[model samples]
Target: MKNESKELATLDYPGGKRRAKLRIVSDRVATATQGDCLRCARVAVRNLIIDGSRRTLGRVREASTSPGLVILGGNEGQAVRECAISDPCGFTAVHAREGAKLNYPESSPWGWSLANGVSIACHNSIVRDNVLTDCTDTGVVVYCSPGTKIEENHVTTKRRSAIGGILLVDAEPFSRDYSGIMVKGNVLDASGQAMRVGIGIGPSVLSDDMETIINDGSVIGNHLTGDYMGYGIATAGLQGWTIRDNLDDARYMGQPSDRCLDDPVNPPPQAFIYNSATLKESVVQDGFFDSDFAYRECVGLIVEVDVRVPGWWDAQHLENAHSS
Candidate 1:
């Protein structure tokens, strides 16, 4: 029983849990306080239809797309356009299920970090044509799925001194198991690390448990800029991981000031290994491993091993190390 005189607000069921708009009115159909929603139409919870359109008033038109933030969507395949959505607890501004979309909008100020911006867990979902900036945390996150089209989305850390950009995660080791995932034509800027995956260590259905877990995947045609604090692409697993056609440049953006003068290549937290990477690909790999870091700090070091080539290193005994 809500107060009739209180402001009447309408939001899409299950979607607008945080009503962006509030209105108070005069009517005895319901009763109670000043900020509660009116429930005059005695309808069951499931049968109740909150007018999602009624809450679209007072929305200032976004002036530009330079910093776009159109956060609107639900589990269904519908259009939630130019919605000034931000900080809905843990949920991103825009989220969609299969065949759903959260379209582009003129950039408006949400004044909140994209703690977790548009998340598309559903297959065949589209998240494109918008400027997603100033998100404090992950942006445009996609989990394990296929037929997901994530393109032309600009995701950046708005903190100015922020760390990292959009994160693509598929913990599953072995790329061949899961078939299709395509991410092309997107811009991610700023942050400590651009993207990360295969967060933990362990064998993922490996021939031997002694090997590390590897995430089988692909990254193609995505532009990453100036977040050298971490590896642009880190895939730490045993096998079935592919890194082809991704770019990161410090020369154009210039290096960060806080970095050390001698070898500014910072440590990447979790790129276990990228076995599929090759010299032919323009992709560059630079970072100091734990052993290298420890050795430098050691004032006194001891122990040496034979440097002679193993008799088994020849073609007569080389097992799987050679591709020929």
Candidate 2:
């Protein structure tokens, strides 16, 4: 419990399983304004342990207001499971437009964001070894959670509209269903995007309800560097997800050669499945650069693209692969 405004520690309990055990260790929670700076909602916040904390700047430090640790599972129904945000160190950027007005009334200043640098809408949670930096949008975000476990974190984003660096979205409409999720060994760096698992349906829904929002996740061995241009690992309308041994230096600066392209009509072992379990291991890799050359070496070989599921309408296609 350090400097706060709207919240810098909140458990808001109201669901079962002997709820209540919020432990925020080595505190240093930072400045907030429109909320969150450590918020664990509709709690069953059980065994919740935010270790070695240090949530940084909020409230005007960009001003999207909120987030630097937000673990909500609202609408209760119980399930914020064994939470833990280890070795924390979430960083700045939040302003989704303040000086130009339209600060908040939800129209899309990112709908005032659920904000990032660690934001899991709860469920078997576990965001390990954290150290998120310069966040604006995402740097660890797993919304529609389910058996979530984003491991060995170390996200980075050198400001400027930073968007992704470990994101498994579901922007809420509630159908939830991101099975067994587990993005392992993280180390995403970003300027725009890097590692994004999809599902953001909207368009008067109805495609058989799109299997009730399925995203059977499992993105393993992460290590995607970035400079922007997005897509180091993207998926949409997922069915049986499982991208493997990731290690992309985030290339796409207008197709430098193509590292992975596959959107030719829902191709895959029927629809999404890369790297073993008999899916044949391969998760995009092309010489891998980014030491300041911005990001280089991107020829080709592992191209099986087709990623487009931000709002969904009936585009249906996602099964890209890559590796080196």
Off by over 4 Å in 1: 1-76, 97-114, 160-164, 170-178, 191-217, 227-229, 238-242, 251-324
Candidate 1 worst ten-residue window by lDDT: 315-324
Write the residue-wise lDDT of candidate 1 on 4-92 in tens digits: 22222234532233434312121211111111123311111111112111112212223222121222222223333332333222223
The segments of candidate 2 whose C-alpha lies over 4 angstroms from its true place after superposition are 1-28, 31-118, 124-140, 147-215, 218-251, 254-324
Instruction: Tally clashes: model 1.
Output: 20
**Model 2 agreement with the true structure over 29-90: per-residue lDDT tens digits:** 42222222233222232323333223222122333323333223222222222333322223
Prediction 2 TM-score vs. true? 0.27
| True-structure lDDT of candidate 1 | 0.32
Candidate that would win on TM-score = 1
CA error at residue 219 for candidate 2, angstroms: 11
lDDT of 1 at 124: 45
The TM-score values for the models, in the order shown, are: 0.45, 0.27
